[model samples]
Target chain A: MSTQTDTRSSAVVAGSFEGDPRRYLRGLGGLLVFLLVWWVGAMTTQPSYLVPGPLDSVRAFIDLFATTTAIVVPVSGSDLVLPTGLAHLTETLFHYVPGLLLGASCGVSLGLAMGWNGALDDWLRPLVRVLRPIPPLAWVVFAIVWFGIHHTGAAFIVFVGAFWINFYGAYGGVEGVSTDLTDAASTLGVERDLSMLKLVALPSAAPQVLTGFRTSIGRCWMIVVGAELFGAPGVGYEIINASNNLAMATSVAYMFLISLAFLCMDVGFRLLEGRVLAWR
Target chain B: MALSSESSVDRESREKITVRNVSRAYDSTQALEGVSLSVGEGEFCCIVGPSGCGKTTLLRAIAGLDDPDGGSILVGGDPVTGPGLDRGMVFQEYALFPWRTVRGNVRFGLDRPACDCADCEARVRELIDLVGLDGFEDAYPKELSGGMKQRVGIARALAPDPEILLMDEPFGSVDARTRDRLHAELLDIWAQTGQTVVFVTHDIDEAVTLADRVVVMDAEPGSVQSTFSIGIERPRERTSREFVDYVARIRDELGSPIDTIE
Candidate 1:
């Protein structure tokens, strides 16, 4: 009896919405339903100030860009005017970018080293395990004390958040490197430990490393907002200040900004990942 | 047959590889014990055995990918301390670097100073052509079929222009038709490059088809059982009486079919 099916199966499962037009319509439908529910909830609330309508929040979001603020330029020592939303957003980015980049760099390096070297793993594993569970926000007290609630203080919190994610990603990736590959490399005249790691292990571990970095990118943004909540100048500060003033719609607007920023970064990174990991 | 008879006198004088009393053990079980064999220069030698026969282990020792627990393996009068560019290896699984393209994989073994130079690029192109993978130089290993991937493995191994080519069932995974085509292509490559080859396989017909000398092995503390010389000429007719006779003799020498089942 023949075992083959009459028709070939598609790679994507049945009913999958990837690259399909219906998925877009469905997404728009979902957003509309959510907005309707939100609007109904706002009408039922005891005080309208507690739960502003989606329209009010949208107006507040637009106002952020229309308003301008003056700030002293560090390099030029001159006053520069920028849109209110952008002024705070730039301050958040100043710490978020450097913190994620530096922490990810150090974490990946250390993780790769530990994964490759058994002795180093043994030496550092205990310390890492003890420090790993302490939340990034918990370090805020120390950050404020050490860096004086400036960008550096918020940056340190973001760094802590980024470091552990990337560390585990790189560590697990290197640990999972195939012995078959290493043996093949050995036969091909790559014998030294460092050379083996570079020529064989590193490339093999690349997908995992990139995956970890991607995860950290999203996680670090969450940390940035939390870090800014304690009187640091950013969207988080705006969120807290607006809520304290009972301008709840302004707080919701900044929250939406955070989500939009995260979505943009995630989409950009995904495109880059697609290019980098095309072989996979 | 006549050609092999004529060359027999000179074969003893050009011993390229000498494995002298090699022994290896894993934990409690002995994989190989006091096994000794020699291959002449430019010779095509195949080792055939059942599962657990340590054929791959012996091949790995020759490649210097593994160290024998006892005894020594000498290639071209020098002891094999570790893997070197002098010897190239082809694995059954086609262990290609997935991240690298066909061109990149083939260029892996080239000396660092020669990399990215015009000559190096030419050499990579030449190897890709040799393995019949000319148009697929830009393709990744994941994109290739089983036969194509093995071809890339062969091209990558030959990139360094080694003196000895050691293969462990390099065509075992491919289908019968592809395996036959690869066999002919491999023989053609072997003839063009006069490198000594030590191939290992479990297939009797395969060993009969490719090897100038087939060495049969037995498992459970694996050691050599017998050796047979195939005097048949190139492009051997598999259905011919002489070819069938050789296959029968070797199969008989391998012992009962029941012994090989497990």
Candidate 2:
């Protein structure tokens, strides 16, 4: 009897596994159709400069890694040549990583404090209400004045974008926690206020908190590209430079690189999130 | 077991719980009005009432999760001020932390200052087995059925081995068949633990089957209306005439004579 039940359950599992690959195939087929339409449109456009085909973009992307670009050395004030793709990509990450980490951490901590404590909510609500309305791009002037036209200035803008997303996510998550969970924790001997927050409130709000982190990551990526328009290093700067030089294919290639980077990071984060919240 | 053994001598001599004129009000609505009850060590008491009877409020008060507006509650002769480790509570919703596995949830109460790491794991394992959730130790609460989740909740509550257990409509959410099995399992655990249990439910039949004594409560003002002593033997037969009589008496006390006929 037990063996029969086991076989039935395993068959059900096998059925689901079969369904997954078919779903992936459908998704891949859709992407191919999209690419075909894009190729036809590019072929009809006058001058390859106006609308570069997928082949042109792909070639430009490969050439970017193989070729070098000359840049003025900051310390010695001498000309130096470096690999364009690697140098620009590293520069973007230097600012993006720091800004995202700093902003998300600060926002989540403050939001949790505000949501959990009535006094903190009252004190900070008005300030957040006033500041959150201002766009992250609006801080570019202040960024330039504070840190000059550098990676630090660009990073500051990315930080502003990431902050609000995480703040609201964590705040709403904490507020959504059911009172029954807290009461259960209390009876389970976690009577202290701090202990209750750590054990019950935080874990209960984790799904929301993780959602906030995921959103902030995507938002920060977009903001970093815009922020780099202010004379910072990275793919954004490369795209702007290529466009100015009328290298439309190169500009499009840089755009694709940014998207590819975002996709890789997003997949990595989703895997981590799956592992962290496996209990769900 | 070492913890229980050390406290066993003191446990036999002490009074389990004393609730004296405990009154709690929310705004103008009185949830509980001057309720008084005392339970002896190792006693199984069930509090039954109609909807909005404040049975849950009373159980929360006993667990020290809520403060009474008037009078006091004591466990083992000590005034109940706040939730303490000596009193464990099982909620109607099971309230198992969704993020924690069955064993992790059971280990939560034992991960206190009073318990060491190795001892806590042992106690968790023992409680998991006691609640018949041995193979499901690593399973998340979401993966379990309603009955299984409540079993985890019961194991979690029992892991600390409190002198008193306060449960608020614990098996009310499960199906009738599952609830019947749970009742038998609960009695077996209660017999082994020898802890004072105060269970709150709206089901008269459940009270009659499980309780040594039933405290019937009224709604609106929310006060204890009457008490009935059940002399039925263990592994109670629901179809038995004595059991039916006990259920009828409690239903009459609830002021619902029509329900008895039904």
Weakest lDDT window of 10 consecutive positions for candidate 2 chain B: B1-10
Residue pairs in clash, model 1 = none
lDDT of each: 0.86, 0.83
Reference-based TM-score of each model = 0.93, 0.91
State the weakest 10-residue window (summed lDDT) of model 1 chain A: A1-10
Native A-B interface contacts kept, per candidate = 0.37, 0.51
Write down the lDDT that model 2 would get.
Answer: 0.83
CAPRI class assigned to model 2: acceptable
* Candidate 2: tens digits of C-alpha lDDT, residues B85-184: 7888999999999999989999988886557887787888888888777777898887777788888898888888887888999997888877888898
Give per-residue CA lDDT, model 2, range A92-209, as digits (tens).
Answer: 8878988888888888898889999999899989999999999998898999999986778888988898889888888998888898888888887886778888988898888888
lDDT of 1: 0.86
> How accurate locally is residue A94 in candidate 1, as Cα lDDT from 0 to 100?
74
Q: Model 2 segments beyond 4 Å from truth?
A: A1-26, A69-82, B1-15, B257-262
